[model samples]
Target: MTEETRNRALIVRGRYDLTVPERALIERGLLLADSLGKKEYACPILNARFVLMPAGTFMMGSPENEPDRCVDETLHQVTISKPFYMQTTEVTQGQWKKVMGGNPSCFKGDDNLPVEQVSWDDVQDFIERLNRQEGTVKYRLPTEAEWEYACRAGSTTAYCFGDDSGGLGEYAWYGDNSEDVTHPVGQKKPNAWGLYDMHGNVWEWVNDRYEDYSSGSVTDPESSSKGSDRVIRGGGWRYYAWSCRSAVRYNGPPDVRVNVLGFRLLSLSSHREIKSEVVTNEQVTSEKLKITSEKLKKLIRLGEEKGFITYDDLNDMLPSDVVSSDQIDDIIMFFIKKNIDIIDPDERETLIVNKPTTGETSRDRDFIAYNNGTVLDTRTNLMWAGEDNKFGINWADAESYCKNYRGGGYSDWRMPTLDELEELYKSENYENVIQITGWFVWASETRGSDAASFYFYDGSRDWYHQSNDSNGRALPVRSAK
Candidate 1:
C-alpha cells in the first residue's frame, strides 16, 4: 500500500491496549465483515468509539506544592453545576478543516493529527461560523471555571490523576513524549474522566474575561463584564509537565491568534431566569433628579435640516464682561441644586439678589447675577439667560443639531425632551412674561413616523406633523440652564 493509504490503515487499526479481550476482536470482525459483503476484510479494525466524560463538581487550581502559584488562583470553592460533552481527544486538523472553511494551522501532518497554532479570537470566529452552518448555538468555548473544573475531574491533587508528576508519561505527551513537535492526538492514556490530552497538546482557549478570584465560594463564575485580555487554560506539549497541572491558569488578549492556541466547545444546560427585587421611590427620585440635572446642562442641538440661530442682532445682546471664575463656580452649583429640586424657598430668595456670605448660592440668584443680561447662542456667551423662549424644529433636524452643533464653545449637545423642557415652566404665573406668540417645536426622542414634538406655549405634546403638513417652516431653537 502507498504511504498515504498505509497511514489511513493505521488510523483504522487504532492502538493496542495493555490488556485485550478475545470478544473485542470478534465483535470488530463481525461489524466490518458484514459491511464488506462477505469479501476478505481490507480493514478488519473499525467502528471503535472514544469514551465520554460524565459531569460533576471538582476543586480547581493548585495546592501549596505547585511550582508557581499566584494569589489569583487562591484555593476557592467552584461548582460546574451542569454536565457537558467534551471531545475524547483534541480537535485534529482534518476535523477542523471539515467544520471551518480553511486550515491555518502551522504544523501539517496526517489528517487525523491535532491542529495547532491558532489564536483565541480565531477560535471564537470559527465557532460562530460553524454554528451558522450547523443551525445551532450549542457550541461555545468552555468558560475558565468550566475548564478548571473539568481538568480537576474531582481530584483535589495538583494533577488530576495524582500528586506525583513522574508517571505523566503514561497519560500525556509533554516535553519528553513530544519531540519538540505535536504528534497525532489520542496516542496516550485517557484521564479518569475519560478525556485524552487535556494536560498537554496545544494550550486551549477558555471563554472568560480575566479577573482575580474572590475568597468565597462561587457557582459557575464567568469572567468580569469587561477586561483587556481573555483567559486561556491547559498546558501544551511544548511545555514541562508541571505546567500542565489541572489548576494552572493563563490568559491572553481576545484578538490574538497564536500557533500554540486552540479551543474546545461546551453546551449550556436549561435553567430558569431569576428576577431582582423592586427599588424604592426614594431611590427612584434620587436617580431621576440626577438625570434631570444632567439633561438641563446639556447644550440644545438644532437638526441638520433646521440649522441654528445665527442672527447678529441676537449675538449683540450678550454682555461683554467676563463673570469671575469664583462666581461662575457658585452659579453652576446653584443650578445643579435647583434642577435636583433640593433648594429651600428662603435660600432661593437670597440667591437671586447676589447677596454675599450666604450658606450657598440660589438658582434664581445665580441665574440673574451670572447670566441675566446674556444672549443664548453667542460664542462669547457662557450661559443662556432666559426663562421662556420659543424653540421649534423638525424631529430629524433636532437630532442632527444635538449630535454636531457646538454651543457655549462645547461640542457635546443633545436635544431636550418634552419633560425636560416642561421642567423650566412656572405654572403659577404662566400668562405674563413667560407667554410667547408662536407655534414652536420642542424635540422628542421618539423615532420614525410616530415621531412627536412638544409645544412650549401650553406644555402640551403631540406627534410631529399629526395635524399640520409634513413640510413646515424653520423651527426656532433655544437653550436653558
Candidate 2:
C-alpha cells in the first residue's frame, strides 16, 4: 500500500481513548495523513483550488506558557462542527482580477501570488458579487475558529509543524525568508490538511468581528457581531515568525486596507445569509474648524488612523514660523493631552495600529464619553464607568468588582485612589463629573482594616471600616493610555 494510504488507515482505526498526551500524539498523526490527499475541489471560474477540512474538536488559543501569546488568546476547546472547503491559498491576484476585473495587489509580478492590499469590507463585496454570478451563498470567509483549526492541522504546537520556529521557512514566506515582500502562494509546503500558505503570506481576514475569546469550550465558535474591528489571522510577509503562529491574532477596522492584508475563501455545504453589517465612520477633520485647528485636526486624524504620528508629520503640519524645539515640545504635549502620540520615526518600520478599535473616546464640550462604556477625565487620561456599582458593598468585594470589571471591552479597571476620587468631585462647581449613581465611592488607600471612601454629596473624604457596606459603592477606573 502507498504511504499515504497506510497513514490514513492507521488514523482511521486509531484508538482515541488513550491518555491525554498519547491521544494527542495519535491526533497529530491523523493530521499528517491528509497531506496532498485528494479531497479537494477546483473552482473552474476562478481557478481556485480548495481542500476539504474535516470536523473535529481542538483546543483553541495559546497556552499560558506559549511564547509571544496575547492575553486575548484565552486557551479553550473549540470544535469546527461542520466540514468545509477552504481555499488552498489566499485568493490570488489572478483570481481577484477574474472576478473583480481589477488587480488590487501591490506586488504585480505573478498571477499566482496571493492578492494583498484588500480589506474585510472589500472581500465582503467580492463575495457578494461572486455569489450572484455563481448563484450560491456557499462562498464566504472562514470563521475565526475554523481558520485556527485548519491552520493548526491537528497539531497542538505553536506552528503547524511544531513549536520550533526555525522550520517555518519550509512552510511559510515570512520576513526571514520572503525578503520583505509577498511571494507566489503554494510555493511553500502545505499543512497536513493540504492547505498552502496558511502561515505567513498576507494577514488573512476571517468572517467575525474582533472580540476576546471565551475561556470555556464552544462549538464552531465565532466572534461577537458587535465590535468595531475584524480579526485578521496568519502573519504577513513582513511579520515575524511568532506573529505567524497558528494562535496569534490581531484585529483592524473592517474598512482598513493595507498592503499586508488579504483574505482566503471558504465554501460551505449549506446556505448562509449574507452579512452586511455597517459601522459608522467618523471623519476627524472638518471645514468648519479654523485653519490652525484644521492642522491639529489632521494630526488627530493621522494619530487615530495608525496609532502614532511621526516627528516628521508634526514638523510638516505645523506653522512654518513656529519652529523651535520648545515650541514642538509644547505642541507634542497638546496632542498628548488628546491621547495621541508623536514620536521619532524609523521609515523602515511598517503598520502603525494607533487606536486598534477606532478611538473609543470622543471629547464633548466638557467630558469625553469613551464609548467603551466609560467616562473619561481628559486631564488625567483616566476612564471610569458612567455609573458606579448601584448598591453598597464591602471594601474587599468592591475591590474585586472593580478589578474584575470588563466594561466596554476594557479589562484594566481597578478601584480609584483617594486623590483620584477627590478629583472626580468638582468641589468648585458642586458637580460630580465622574457621575456615579451612588453617593459614597471606595478608594484603594487603606489604614489596616479601614479604607478611604469619597463622598460626592459634600466633597468630603474619610476612612471607613473595610467591611463597611452602608452607602459604599465601588467605582472602576482605568488609564486610557
Candidate 3:
C-alpha cells in the first residue's frame, strides 16, 4: 500500500461524514482483503483460514468522545514489532471437534459457526492438542494488544468498518441482526487486513491476564504474567454495536464458560512481510475520533453528580451546535437517556443545599444502619440490602436473585426500580446506606425484553437485554415495616 493510501485508510468519520478520498481508500482496502493474492494459510487439519497481518503502530483504545465509551478504554499508542498470522475468523465447532474430539459449543449445527461456551482453560487444552498435531506450526491465543491491533486492521474507528453503527449489520453478527444467537463465520465483510468477525459474534479470549492498561507508548505490549481473569474481546452476538467496538474489552475467570465466550488462534511462524499489506515505513497516527461535543460530556457528568441539571447549566455547557435550532432535540434526548432532567434555574439552589455531609449535620440522618446486612430509610420506609449480590449477573438472573433474597432474613426483598435508584442517589449517606462496590446496579424497571441499569459512579441509566451480564449488579430492597 502507498504511504498516502495507508494514511487515507486511517481516517475515520461517521457513516455520512466521510470525504470522497476517505470512502475510496476504505473500498480499496476491503478489495485488497478480499483478493485471493493476499497472504493466507488454510489449515490442513482444522480447516481454518489464517491471514498474514503486517506489523504497524495504532492508537490502542477509544478516544473519550466516542459514544458509549468505558473508562478502562483509555487511549494510547502501540507498536506491533513483528508480523504474525491471525485466524481469518474465530475457531468453528468443526475445527474444535476435529481436534478435541468433542463439541462444547452452546450454539449447535453449522460446523461453520464460531464455537462458544468454552472456557479459557478449555481453550488452552485445545491449543495444546492442536499444537502437538501441527508438529511444525504452532497455535496460541493472541495477546490483548495483538488482538486489538489485528481487529482494528488499520482503521481508527469504533469498529474496523467505521464509526457509524448503521453499517454494522453488514460487517458483524451483533444484537440487531444476530437474532440473539451466534451465526456462521465468514458471512460478513472482512476488515482491511482480510480478517473476519473481529467485532462481534462471540467474545474471543486473549492470552494475557486481565489488567488496566498502563499509560504510555508501548511496543508489542503484553498483560501481567498472572491474574484471576483473562481478557475477552470482540463482544458477542447478543451485544450491541458499542460493545463490539475495536477498543471495547471485558474479562472472565479462566474456568467460567458461557455461550457468549469463545476464542480464535494466532499462528506462530517466521515473519514474511506481505508487500501489498505492509505499511511500516511511516507511523500512521490515526485521527482521534471527535464525536459528541466536549461540553456535553462535562454537562452530563455534572448532571450525574447533582441528580438534575438546570436550564442555566445547559446554557453554560452546551455548544452552539448542540443547542442550535436543528440539534435542540438531540441535546434533550441525550440527557434524558442519561437520566438527567433539565429544571428551572430557581431549583438549582435547592438541589445544592440538599447535598448532605458527614459533619454533625448528618448525625440524625433518616437512613439507619444495622449490624445485620441491611439499611432502613426512615424517610421512605424502605429497607435495602447493605450490599449487592457481590458479583455480576445477567438481568434475568438478577431479577430472580433479588426476588428470592433472604438478606436480613427478610422474605419480601425485591429489586429496586429506576425511580428507587434515583431516590437512593439523592441519599446523603449513599456510600453508607447501600454500599456499591461495583459500577452498575440492576433495577426492576423493564422495557420489553430489556431491563434498566444504573451506573453508580457516573449516575447514568441504561436498559440492556436480559442476557447481557456485563457490569450488572444486584442490590435488593423492600418496604420497611
Candidate 4:
C-alpha cells in the first residue's frame, strides 16, 4: 500500500511491529498514538476495540470547593507520564467468552454489553489467558491513577462533560436513565477523548488499592499492592450520577465479584522499563540499601522527632513502599497519615485552632442566634438552620426544603454539601447549638436514586438508597455572608 493509504489505515489499527511502513508512521508520530483525539486498535483475538489515551497531567481528586465532594478526595496533582491504550468501552461478554471460554456477566444476550460480576482475581485469570493467547503480557487493568486520568479525558469537572450532572444523561446510563439494566456499549456520547461508557456502564476494576489521598503532587502513581481492597471506578447502571464522578472512588476485595463490577484492559509496552530483580546478599547488605524495614523505621522516626516530612512531600512519594504489603487498612492508615502530617494529635490541634476566624471562639460555644430560625456558626463562618424536632424527609424533599427555606432571614439557604456537613461533625461536639442526635442528616450529594448522609453520633458518612424510603433530617446551611 502507498505510504499515504498506509498512514490512513494505520490510524485505525496498531499492531506491534518493526516494519518499514510502521517506522514511517512512527516517524510522523502517528503509530504509537494520535496527538489529538483517539487512536483505535482492534484486538485480533477478541475483536475488541481499544483507544489510545494521551499522556497528560490533571488534578486527581475533587477540589475542596467542589459540591458533594467526599473527605477522601483530597485534591492532589497527578501526572500520567506515559501514554497507554485503554479499551474504548468496557470489556464485553463476547470478548470475555472469546478469551476465557466462558462469560460470567449477569446481563447476558447482548454481546456488546460490558461484562460484569467478575472479581479482580477472575479478571487476573482472564488477563493471563488473554496474554497467553496474544503471546505478550501487554494487557492488564489500569492503575487507579491511570483509570481516573483516562476517565477525565483532560476534563477536571465532576463528570467528563462538566460539573452539572444534568449533562450526564447525554453521556451515561445512570440511575435515572438505565432502567436498572446494562445496555450495549458506546450508546452514549464519548468523553472529550473519544472513550465511550466511562461515566456509567459498570464500575470498572482498577489496579490500585483504595486509600485516602494526600494533598500534594504525584507522578505516575500506581497503588498496585498498597491495600487489600482493589479500586473500582465509574458508576454502574444501578448507581446515581455522583458515584460516576471522575474523582469518586470505591473499592472491594479482590475476590469479591458483584453484578455491577467489571474491568477494562490497559495496554502499556513500557512495562519492561521497570523490572523486579531478586534481592541478593550484596545488594540487601549494602549500607545505603533502598528496601528494608530499618530505612522505613528511620523515616518514621524522623517524622516523630521533627516535622521532617511535609504533608505535600509525603504525598509525592510513591505509596508502594510506605507500608507493608500485607498490612491491613487500619494499621496502614497510621503510617500513611503520619507521613502526611495528620496522625500527630498536635498537628490536628494546630489545624483546628489556626483557622480564619469569624470572631467565633470555639471554646465558648458561641452561636449568633437569629430571629428567622437560623444560627450562624462563627467558627466555620457558615449559617445553619435551627434543627426541627422532626425525624427526616426523602433526599429530594430535603433539598427542596433547603431551597424554599426563608429561615435566618435568608432565601438562599440550601442543604449543606457533604464536605460542609463533614466539617460540622468535629465542631458539633463543642457547639451544642443544634440538637443533633444519632440520626443521619441529608447532604446535597446525590448518586442516582441514593444520596450521601452524615451521622452525628460517630461522625460517619455514607450513601443510602433514596428509594429505601429511609428518613434523614435536613440541616440547611448557606454562606455566612
Quick one: best lDDT, which candidate? 3
Please give each candidate's TM-score: 0.45, 0.49, 0.50, 0.50
Please provide, for model 3 over 170-215, each residue's C-alpha lDDT reduced to its tens digit, 9 standing for 90 to 100. Answer: 8899999999999999899999988888988999999988888878
Better of 2 and 4 by lDDT: 2
Off by over 4 Å in 4: 1-38, 269-481
Question: Backbone clashes per model, in order?
Answer: 10, 2, 0, 4
lDDT of 2 at 463: 88
What 10-residue stretch in candidate 2 is worst by lDDT?
270-279
Error of 2 at 12 (Å): 38
**Model 3 spans with C-alpha error above 4 angstroms:** 1-38, 271-481
Candidate 4 lDDT, 9-29, residue by residue in tens = 333222121223222332232
Order of models, best lDDT first: 3, 2, 4, 1
lDDT of 2 by residue, 1-481 (tens): 1344324323422111112222222223211122223367676557788877877899999999999888988999997766778899999987775444345678878988888888888899778645533433468999999999999999999999999999999999889988888998899899999999899989999998888888788998777668789999999999899999999989999898788999999986421111112212333233322454456566667776766777678668764433334234334433443445555677315435433333344555445664334677776777777666555577886887676555554557788998987876763331334456566888999999899999887889998999876678887889988
Residue-level lDDT of model 1, residues 1-481, one tens digit each, is 1244324323322111101211221222212112211111110111112332344555666656566665567777776655554555676775565433235677775856677666776777666534433323345788887777767667787777888888888877778777777767778877776677788877888888888886778787887787778887778878888778887778888777666666666543211111112212222244443443343233111111222111221123211221233222222222222222122335545444542322222233223222111223222122322221222334554454343322222334455555544543433232322333346444555655656565655777676653342332122234444
**Regions of candidate 2 where Cα sits further than 4 Å from its true position:** 1-38, 270-481
Residue 176 miss distance in model 3 (angstroms):
1.0
